[model samples]
Target: MPITNADVVAVFSEIADLLEIEGANPFRVRAYRNAARMLGELGRSVRTMVDRPEELDALPGIGPDLAGKIVEVVTTGSCALLQRLRKELPPVITELLKIPGLGPKRVRTLHRELGIETLAQLRQAAEQGRVQSVHGFGAKSERQILEATGRLLQQERRYKWADMEPVAQALLADLHATPGVHRAVAAGSLRRGRETVGDLDLLVTAENPGTVMDRLTASEDIQRVLEQGVTRSSVVLKSGLQVDLRAVAPASFGAAWLYFTGSKAHNIALRKLAQDKDLKLNEYGLYRGKQRIAGDTETAVYKALGLPFIEPELREDRGEIEAARSGALPRLLQLTDLRGDLHAHTKDSDGHDPIEAMAEAARAHRLHYLAITDHSKRLALVHGLDADGLSRQIDRIDEINASLRDFVLLKGVEVDILEDGSLDLPDAILGRLDLVVGAVHSGFDLSRDKQTDRLLRAMDHRCFSILAHPTGRLINERPPCDIDLPRVVRKARERGCFLELNAHPARLDLSDAACRIAKSEGVLVSINSDAHSRLQFDSLRFGVSQARRGWLETGDVLNTRTLGQLRSLLAATMARGVGQ
Candidate 1:
């Protein structure tokens, strides 16, 4: 199999983690980390780009040295540096970093002081109450560690949605190209747009099932073929993602798709409805007295059940069925519904692209406007803007806007919300921008009450426009900080502010449940790509899927509005006084 971007990212990320545990230079470690993130989010494949070294070197944060490493990873599937680092460290030490709240420094402390090298050892130490005795760790920290370790031990491994995309695409393409295959489609939680996917389920219609099975098992990406048959096959990929491929007759394709693309709860509810109607529903077909009534299409099945067609994303048994029955199902948000992207970054902050490049990219993606919400000075690592920097950028935006045609770039700042619920930039500076996106970059361990109050106070600010990445999570890497999100949604509704559904694959914050809450509270949600680089606009698809899962319609999203409509809404929030 060709080296995928995800493959390169995994190698780079592991190297960075091991280097951090080895107490390597912060700059050196950060280089690897940034390269990993960039490649992971890069739309183009690194393997295909290897012939053009200049393109790799031109990518932001990837110097010639890092570019060479990427080439090496793509060419050889593994780099010498990663191998050396893995050998030098206690192989499993990096596993310690997987626990929430335990960064490299803490992992090093535990390793050096207590000889803790594995989760089993760490758990034993914590259970013995010795973890708190270490420096920089208190009883509370120790307790959290214990609980996190326990959860990690018991949790089944699941891959992030983005991580599985490339592999899934490759397999689907191969299936479509197979000689006897008629159609192939991915289903299950993947089709539902879940944040994380446990396993992949693929359904195919083929003239000859044996031909498809043979092609599937012959792929280089298949690490192991657990089972292979004429009609069904299961395999584990090189990345450890399990894939199940099933061949169904064309007549039964829709039934199989519906049966496999289900939350167990959703399937149960659907079965009950079928039973109530004296009909039988299964992977074969919907039947009455052994006579097939509907099966070839999902629409026909739903219609037979006396309900409208429920979108795959809304098939999570979360009131979607009830709504479908009552003819109240929402027309879920679509990628094209967004008229603008309200959160983006540039070299002004940690983003790779320049302001002009980002604007061009958004315009190319069919957006009418793009917001340049660079980080504020509080996030020192990103070279975030101070008051003067923001002022200069504001003037720069005015100059660029004068030159542009229909598309416009909005002057904005992703200002940090301080611990005491204050804005990082002054009101005067923030008041000068098109919008202000308040974010929480620190104090993830704050009590739920304090965190909620912190966000509430920030939203109450006269200049606040939206809350960015409200939960502050990094998918499987870190848990969301404790906070009352429903309360925050209600507060936004009350204050005329909005909440962000950050579309970055790593931080799909303002989760599906939160989006539903915002919709219920009548607070518009902004589905932003939070594009740090140009290609990241592709991430908006994931955000749209997340919104669909949350039951968001075009009207429920703030960015779905036209420029004039959006300006009016934002103006109301920006000019409002406290408690208004």
Candidate 2:
């Protein structure tokens, strides 16, 4: 199989982490990190651009050397420098960096001071209070480390949905194209749009099970054939993703899909429901004493059970069964329902694209409006905008808006909520913009009450519109902060402010449960792309998936409204007795 963009990005990222732990040159470390980000932001796969040296070199962060390394990784599946670094550092040391509270410097400190190289050793040190004695880590930080380590230890290895999607798509396409295969789909957690998937459950309806199995086993992507049977087969992909392929008869395809696509709890409840109806439910079909009542289609199966067809994303046994039976199933939010993206960056910040390009791309993506919410000055590394810079950008947006047709670029800033709960930009400038998106970029380790209070104070600020990326999390990289989310959601509702579901692959914060909380509190959510580049507008699909999982409807989303209606809603957040 060909190398994917994710593959190259992963290697480069790991190299950056390993190099950081090794105390390599700071610039060298930044180069690797920047290259990884560049590759990740590139819409096209680096694999496709490998042959075009000029194209690779033209990327914002890529130099000739890094470009060559990217090409090397794509062509050869590995890099010699990364391999040498891996050899120099124990593999376990890199794994420590994954624990939330532990960064490269802290990992180095633990290794150098306590000779800790593994989670177990780190745990031992924490328990023995050795961690508190480290220069930077105190008692509270030590406790956090222990807690984070415990979570990491219990967690199973899983691949991010973004990373596994291409693999699943390519595999399903290949399977469906097989001569005897009639239909194919990736089921299980993947179907549910879980943040990460442990393994792939594939369902196939085939005319000849033998031929289908033969083709699957013969695929080049198969690193190992775990099993091969007439009705079922299992294989391990080159990337270590295990796939279980079940060949079903056309008549049983629906039942098979349901059984495999299930959350185990959901299936158990469904089976019980079938049992109550004096029927037996299995992968083959629903049976009433050897007579099949339903199996051919999912709708038939659901109808026979006296329940509406529960969307795959809602089949989590989270009262969906009861809701379906009572006709309370929500009209789940769809991608088409999103009218705009409330949070996006431009070249004025760390973003790769200019404001015009980002707006055009969002328009091309079918959005009616987009907010140019570039970072504020507190984020020095991104060269975030100060008051003067934001004023200039606002004027530029106005100039651009005058020329646009059918779309509007909302003047906005991703203003940082300082550690003390104050806005980074002055009220003079913030008042000039259409909206302000307050974010917590630093001071993540504050106590729960303090963090919640900090956010509440920021929401009290007259200009605060949406709380961007609520519960500061970076997917698998960082755990969410210690703030009380229920309290935060309630506060947002009271303040007439909204929260953002950042759609960036790295930071899909304000998680499914958070979205549900916001929904119940009548606090609308902005399913924003948080796009740093034109291509990133595509990330809205992931945000939409998360929203559907949270049971959000079009009305629950802030950006789903038309421009005129949206402005009315935004104006409410700025109302504070007409005071600064």
Candidate 3:
């Protein structure tokens, strides 16, 4: 098998753990960890260049010795030293090193004295008072261990944007309702439109900061008060969420909100531009010499810099300043620009709502049209529809359309693209649908070449109207699959297929960079929520933000067109394929 960087990093991390357990030199162990990180971030596979180990040595921290070891591992399946160490040590002992507050020495002590090999055994010893009876582990240490063990066991993992949005909205509501609070808005990663937020940050403009802070600290939802100051407070929610509230004066609210709602790189670039123009930018406000220039809104601040306002999502230091300066900033698509939602599920699949309920929700949102893109038959867990089931759904849609005076519902299928790049539903089934969203549900680990080919072939399908979340990445959890995104975008454009900027935060696949490249290549994008539930439809804001970040305009997005216009575009696409 061709070794990936992840494989190399895992092996190196294992080595580092074993070395630390052996009480090896700290720097030597640190060097290995550093090398592992360097290799993991490399754009190209290190294994492919194993013959010339010097290429590895040229990387920041990797030296001749480490490079030689990399070569050894690549040439053979294992390294002699690592294999010898593995034989001498029990794998269970190595695992203990992963627990928090228990480093190598502590792990070795637990193994030798307490005879503990795993977290469960260690927890049992702590609960039974055996851990406290040990010389180094006092009652306090025992309690700490039990707590850490519980934390490790109950770790809920990171929440996707879809998962975290409700929590954030609840917190915002609480903050807004609190006495002395004038206004409350979510800032930081949440506002910057990041797919996965490290924590929720709410900025509050309060008449009395101390009272607001006290109210927040005393809230029933707070699990622990991490920090409290007169103007700022941080707390951990009972649900393993960290929330920070910063109180600001009404006068400085805009600047504070803008500063905190930063993609740090974007702020840094803005500051540099301000400095060059003999101005100062900070959380307080924009200043020229000693006088405050703009302190109320982001637009005012940008205007002070002699530029049109930049959207928060595009504030990522990615040429926004130059684009603003040139007066050529792309007219980014907005939530109101979308005429329809193309990817939505109902009880027809695994969705919680019925078709009429989903339609009502879309109508409430004033959407011109909505597509019921339920899963195809391959996703059995989702109760994916076969041809018969789909035909029934189409009949229901037609009935609903006949009854409705407004808001059209289109017959669509989110068809699975099998590993071999073939649609789950054949052309016969696909040809009957108004829309088809081709997506990859499994075989995520295919090699780059295979994965690219799979998607490219799927795009060639006459029924493939849109490529959904092309890379299949979950932010901070799964990295993008090995597919050349630019090439995929190019293929989609050439094939007259729109690429989806999936709005469900966790899977903002075909991310901002891919969106920009796709637009440049003449590919249209659809800002889709991929909403499975009614509440999740609001995630379109994130999708709009992502599209704005890519400088996408109404012209570049399929949903930006009116219902009639979109139908014409689809008809034209079909006609083009037929003519070819």
Best by TM-score: 1
Q: Where does candidate 1 stray beyond 4 Å?
A: none
Give per-residue CA lDDT, model 2, range 470-528, as digits (tens): 88989788878899999999988888889999877778787888888999999999999
lDDT of 3 at 171: 68
TM-score of each candidate? 0.96, 0.94, 0.69
Residue pairs in candidate 1 whose N, alpha carbon or C atoms collide under 3 angstroms = none
Model 1: per-residue lDDT, tens digit, 398-503?
Answer: 9999999999999899999999999999878888998999999999889999999999999999889989999999998888989988888889988999999998
| Candidate that would win on lDDT | 1
RMSD in order of candidates: 1.8, 2.3, 18.7
Give the alpha carbon lDDT tens digit for every residue of 1-580 in model 3: 2344555666787788788877889999888876765554343567668877667767556789888888887776457778877887766676566454577888877777878878789888988999888777789889978877776666545545544555576667777777878898888876766656778888888788888788789876678999999999999976567889898887788888888988889888889889999999999899999999997887888898888988777777888889899997888787998888999998789775788887887877778899999999999978999999998998889999998877899889999999988889867777888888989988887899999999988888777788998898866545578998888987877778789999876677768788899889998898887877554577687788777777889999989888888888776665544210
TM-score of candidate 3 relative to the true fold: 0.69
Q: Residue 448 error for model 3, in Å? A: 0.8
User: Which residue segments of model 3 deviate by more than 4 Å?
Assistant: 1-159, 533-536, 578-580
Candidate 2 local distance difference test against the native: 0.88
Better of 1 and 3 by lDDT: 1
